[model samples]
Target: MRRKILGIALILLAGLCLCLSLNQADKYRQAEKTYDDILEKYTKEKKVSKKKQDFVVDWKKLWKTNKDVVGWIKMDSGADYPILHGDSNEEYLHTDLYGDYNINGSIFVNADNSRDWSDPNTIIYGHRMNNGSMFGSNKKYMEKDYLKKHPDFSIYRPDGCYVYKIFNVMVVEDGTYPYTYQFPDKKSYIEYLSKVKQYSYYDSGITVPDARQIVTLSTCTYINHVKKRLVIQGYIRQIREYKGMVQKRKINILEDNAFSKTEMEDTNDKEID
Candidate 1:
């Protein structure tokens, strides 16, 4: 009787573990579904041109539900995702664009930074999801060949596109100087850049000048016993006006001059590249 009772207890334990595993798997599935729904809506509303190879954002559709979405980030080919900026940096760490709870959070920017890209240094945070959803592919940068093939990524804004050339990739402890937003002077900023460049695993041959904006992509790393972060730093290299194949109305000089200063300013909200 004792042996039989013990065997039954073991079966119950196994069943409990299976149930927990299934619950975790369901969470991932729900997260994927949420992303798919957003993508479907966006692709349907936006126009696509094969010749130009551009995927423009449909601001009208996106702003209806969530106004926090500021821009989009596309890494190489398949890793394109909409970037979100919440009032608090920790808000989206567990919540999706639709306000659903999931382990895979939205790609978020630090609340302290400006959403208009005015800050000299902007930091974006994402989780390294096991299912290759958020920043899982960011690990590929550690491999030299992978970095070579994917040298740069583009950020799309309503006004234009900003291209950033990857210069440094390193894994350091959390709360380090790289993640800090405090730079008192140009000399301090340059010194911090030098430190990051020195510790870079590979010399990417990309330099960071004082005038250009800098962006840092950060993710959690678990290789070391203590908590660490995988940081990829890049500086803006170029800014190009977004063009499309479809040309609607051609404005003559007279028509352009007819608009007042306020009207023109409202049309094109100036943003720092």
Candidate 2:
């Protein structure tokens, strides 16, 4: 009789674990759908030339949804999401873009760094989810070949769009080097850059001279359960002014023709369907 009771309890425990796993999976699916909807609503790609294209985000619409929306980040390796700036670093760790609670949190900038992108180094954080959401794909940087193929990513702000070239990919203990926000002098900042490149898994051959603005993408890694973080660092390569007006219609521009005189004159003009 005791043996039968023990068997029944074991089966019940397994059923409970299965139910919890299924519930968590459903939550992730819903979270993914929400992000996909946001991307479709507020972002569109514009053909610059016959061979080139660029994407634009409706910064005005994003801000309207949540004033905390600061910028958007995109990478070819399946990382595209709106960035949020919360009151503290911990605010968005478990909060989604719509301020909802989920294991998959929104990408957020370091609270101590300047949101204007004027700081010497700005650090961005995201969760390394199991289903390759958020910064999960960032782990590919651990392989040098992957980094070579995908060395660049873009960030869009209200003022302009900025491109950053990845220079270093390193794994380190939390609260260690390269997590710093402020540097008292240029020399110290340069030294920090040197250490970043020095400790990288492989040299990316990118430079960060003159302390140009740099951004760090950080995500958790469970290599040995020692609280290691995978950090991908990059420096700004280009900046293009954002001049289009936000409207319901899509904003399309030709690179060869450039912005027309009328468009330049009326920066606030809405797009006509």
Candidate 3:
């Protein structure tokens, strides 16, 4: 008949282009197997919750215990990242090119970029990574003896866990840019928090008293690479608890990212539709 109906329409257009390339490789293998099961459930809950918090970080007793800290930030820490607007409603923001977690560049705030835990200056941005991993020990807060030997960084919140006490670290010259992490007022956010503590490299006997609440971690350097931006300021502290309480709530800090780690369990196996 007309070459068997053009060979059955060329084998049904090669079975519909092999079922649309196996459905776009099954949506990047279900976003790489949900980022390797959230990086092996946040590297085994960051080693049993930093050995049950003796490692110390008391955000008013870890946000009053169970007030639901964004289900402790969607696990994984071999360190792959992408939370900035993983979608919308403010889709638990954290920005979409606006970012954090080693995956390079752009942030501005009152930032929750939706790392959501009822935001209040959650302001975060990362990529100080030089393979040590994201915020790559943010250059140990510019070495005033590595900011007194790495001040702090622990954040497990499936209900409780917090500690980010580097208090301040600095280097800001892209035209005095630190009024970010947002501030319409608090007297222009304490005049850009006392001009970013005159660029503090950690004396953090700490006192912002009330910029409402804070957390700022920014990155990008090489002004010799000539672009500048390498900041790390961790303000919210003393919310310690193995139990309950989480107060600051008026959040909408939009734009961001998260969840992931190394080799991602050898390219995260298969079957994810």
Candidate 4:
């Protein structure tokens, strides 16, 4: 009789575990659908020419949904999502893009960094989910071949779109050099960059000189239960002015005024090639 009772209890425990797993899976599915809806609604691809295409985001529309919507990051490895900024770094650990709670949190920039991307080293953090969402695929960069194949990624902001080339991929303990947000001087910052490159799994042959900004994507790693992080660093390569509705209207009006003996020039926005 005791054996039979033990067997029943074991079966009951297994059933409970199965139910919990299924519930978590359902939550992930719902989270993914929410992000998919956001991507479909606010972003689109514009064909500049037969050979050139531009990825555009309606920043004005996105901001209406959430003022925290800072930018959108895209990579050729099928990693695309909206980036967010909160008052505190811990605010979005379990929050979704729609301000709901979920295990698959949105990719977010460090709260200490400037939202305008002016900081010398901007660090973005995301969960390394088991389902290969968020920054899960960033681990593939450890292999040099994969890094070479997908070397470039783009971040679109209200001001413009910035392209970055991947330069270093490495695993490091938490609270290390990669997490440094401020530099005391130019020489210290340059030395930090050199140290990070030396720790890379393989040299990407990309140099990040002084006065240039870099963005680092960081995610957690669970190797033997040690607290470590996988960091992928990239340097800015190009900057393009956002050519959306506002810019187009401004250009047309300026052209019409030019014919009427009125001269106007936009000296603020410039592209970095």
Candidate 5:
């Protein structure tokens, strides 16, 4: 009787483990699918143009109209959504009770707490979906050889497309998992980036690289959701201006106009390149 009871217990344990494993896998699959659906919607709404190969974002509508919903997370590809940070408007990780289109994690550039978007080596976060969508595609930057293509790209408010080149991919160190985002000063900011650049998977095409400005997109994965980070690094190559700078800057223009004044004030919003 004792032996028989023991055997039954073992069987139950095995079943429980199997159930948990399957359940976890299903969660990831569902996560992957959710991001895939988002991609489809984004692609269709973007309306691709092979000739120009451009994606546009309307700054005015993004920061204003979508603030309550997704909140200013717009890509040059015409993909705009409100960032679903934490439950509170001040938090970074966002969750939706319904599950669909709800990202259960927060996004941080550089570190989780830092908001300085201008720092180079900004690390962003998201989940890597088994479906190879959303931040999951960020994992592609891990392989050293694959670093050749897959350059980082960005679209700034008002109008601009900044291209990024991959340069680093390293496992997040234990003490540094919840990477801090803010810095005390610009010098420290640049110095810290130098440290991260040392871990770049490759040269990333830019020599004598310095940390002037950058944006990092991060997600959860690896052990305890802290070990691995698929970091795609890049610097802005050039800005594409379809409708010349209405909000311009002194350095970016020759004439003294409204656009130039705006540009000058917004000039601080540059990415590392």
Candidate 6:
């Protein structure tokens, strides 16, 4: 009887382990559902708002649901994720956009960067899940072919849409000092770009002159150690007015080839969050 009882206990433990594994898998599904719901609601509201002037997202409604939401991120390769901003990088590191505690935390910007997307280097973070959600596709940037094929992604703000071209992609140690927003002078900013290009996986042959905005997408990668990270940086190539809808629309910008040169170009800069 003692042996039989021990065998039964072992079987029950196995069942419990299986259930826990299933629960973890379900978390990714839940994250997907949450994002879909928000997108659906945004679509509906966007349609309704077209009749009014100043076509922009219903920030009032979005804030009511989650004050952390700052803007939307969309990739040419079809990675569309909502960008959330919290008091600190840690706040949304483990929390979803809806305040739910999930391992697949919402895509978030570092607290060091401005919430308005005004910073010269706006770095965004997301988990690198095995299931290829969030920034999982970030690793593809390492391939020169992939970079050439899908060279651009865009950030949609309430005021307008900004298109960025992938200029450099790197796999660097976590907390790399060169990736921070602490650059004081224009010379330092140019030097930072040089370091990133020097360490990039591919030369990319793309450069960001001073005065142009940049965005960096970062994710975890287990390359010899868990602390290694994949970083993809891009410079703003174009900007268009939001046009009161989420679909692709175009507008004129102040200049073409804004970042084509190696020197600072004039910009009618404005603040955003």
In terms of TM-score, which candidate is strongest?
4
Error of 5 at 149 (Å): 2.3
Score candidate 4 by lDDT: 0.78
For candidate 5, the per-residue lDDT at 86 reads 37
How good is model 1 by TM-score?
A: 0.82
Instruction: Flag regions of model 6 displaced more than 4 Å.
Output: 1-10, 44-57, 244-273
lDDT of 2 by residue, 1-273 (tens): 999999999999999999999999999998899889989999998887799677888878888889998899998778999999888999999898778887788999998877666567789999998889899888988998998888888888876677788888889877787788677666677778877776787777778754656889999997766768999998876665555634232221212223111233213322211
Reference-based TM-score of each model? 0.82, 0.86, 0.26, 0.86, 0.60, 0.79
- The 10-residue segment of model 5 with minimum total lDDT is 253-262
Candidate 6: tens digits of C-alpha lDDT, residues 153-268: 87777656677888988888878864676566556666677777777877887787544668888888877666688888888876655444434422322233232222223232
Residue ranges of candidate 1 with Cα displaced over 4 Å:
44-50, 224-226, 244-273
Alpha-carbon lDDT, every model: 0.73, 0.79, 0.46, 0.78, 0.46, 0.73
Deviation (Å) of 128 in candidate 2: 0.1
Question: What is the C-alpha lDDT profile of model 4 across 123-187, one tens digit per residue?
Answer: 99998988888888777887899988888888887766778878888888877877786666556
- Any residue pairs clashing in model 6, and if so which? 55-244, 116-272, 116-273
Model 1, 38-144: lDDT tens digits are: 77776433344555455667867887878888877878624566788999988999888787787888988888887876565789888888787788778889887
Model 5 C-alpha lDDT per residue in residues 1-273, reported as the tens digit of each score: 999999999999999999998987776666545545543443323444655444454444433523322323443322233233233432434333123344433332323432323333345554555554446555555555555554444534344444444444555552363244456555665566667666564555453254434455554357465556545444445444444565454222212221121135434235334
lDDT score for residue 146 of model 6 = 90
What is the per-residue lDDT of model 3 for residues 54-122, given as tens digits with 9 covering 90 to 100? Answer: 322333332353122232221122224322323222322322221222122312232234455344345
C-alpha RMSD for every candidate = 7.4, 8.4, 19.7, 7.5, 6.8, 6.8
Q: What clash pairs does model 1 have?
A: none
State the TM-score for model 4. 0.86
Clashing pairs in 2: none
